[model samples]
Target: MDAIDLASLLCSRLCHDLLSPVGALNNGIELLADEQDPDMRERCMELLSESARASANKLKFFRLAFGAGGGFGDEIDTREARTALEGLYGADKRIDLGWMVTDEKMAKGAVKLLLNLGMIAGDALVRGGRLDVGAEQRDGALEMVIRAEGPRILLDPKLREVIAQGHSGGEVEPRAAGAWLAHSLASQAGGSIQLNDPADEVLLIGVTLPN
Candidate 1:
């Protein structure tokens, strides 16, 4: 697909993901306005706070992964990326993150690729699991590895195709837009993405980019 097409797909994905939390925010507001019981009103306030936090977290993640975040600098602080990932996943407490990147900073493209891969892996944990992310620079290249282990993992075959081959036979779907973007970033950086056998109990994704 062309740039415009890919952009539209990403936008659709973002909207779809945000709709639930945003809608919850709206509903909480309405309920708060109509409720007279102090306990119920306090409950609505809690709901609204959670929904607002969710919305903000998603936006922060999308900005760095899919938009021009971290300013116009060529390199981005790894700490910022960690915070973004934590906000997106830590808030829900469904997945535990173990970060192992020793570098203080990484190129913008590498940061985006890493975050996208993290998101994909975290989502695959259908039964709530552990996600371990590691990165190191060697041989004038930046390498990243993300592993997801859970009771049940359910990664879409199309996403695997996109990450491995940069396209999924035909047009890319909105849900796999992040994978597409990750593939594009890697390819643009003279990098490659590798995935372990899908049949394996754990999901492993590795990416390498020339530095």
Candidate 2:
């Protein structure tokens, strides 16, 4: 409900995600310093590169997801959102993305909703299945849909509740910050976020914002 709390939560979430890759960077540097074997040295360098890339990807994704990206404007290029998401999950090579957006420009808050909702749905794909992100104008409203399907899907009960409805005055946590933000933004725009009842293999997230 407050900007300060939301900022702190998002910061914690970013730090939590970056920890592994950044820690890998440190370990890789230490290994490189101690290794003398040519093959081991090469492996260390490779590890360093991989860790750096991972760290960069996470930052890029967060920049768009949680920050006022590129400017102070109310709208942003939709392609940027797609690229940010692809950067975040593309390297893993597990989940396949099906981007079905046709709009060139979208309200910044709308794009943020899509990005965060996509992140939550994608996380549910424990086995890294398919993620389909689609958005368009319908009946003078902007509709965003994100569907995640995999062999096994696991969604946190609290997250499911928070995304579709709200915290209901409950305490906020770092992991749910994105979903919470999406919900808040949608409400501010006189819109609502929704979630389909989880099936055996699929989870669906949807949002609609006023024009």
Over 1-211, each residue of candidate 1 has an lDDT whose tens digit, in order, gives 7789889988998999999999999999999989999999999999999999999999998999888775649888999899999998999898999999989998888999999999999999988999999999889888899999999999999999888888746777898999999999999999999999999999999988887
Winning candidate number (lDDT): 1
lDDT of 2 at 19: 100
Q: What's the C-alpha lDDT at position 23 in model 1?
A: 100
lDDT of 2 by residue, 1-211 (tens): 6789899999999999999999999999999999999999999999999999999989988998998877738788888888889988778889999999879988888888899999998888888989999999998899888999888999998888788776678698899999889888899899987787765467887778778
Give the best candidate by TM-score: 1
User: What TM-score do all the candidates reach, one by one?
Assistant: 0.97, 0.96
Candidate 2 residues lying further than 4 Å off, grouped into runs, are none
The models' CA-based lDDT, in order, is: 0.91, 0.88
Clashes of each: 0, 0
Residue 155 lDDT (model 1): 95
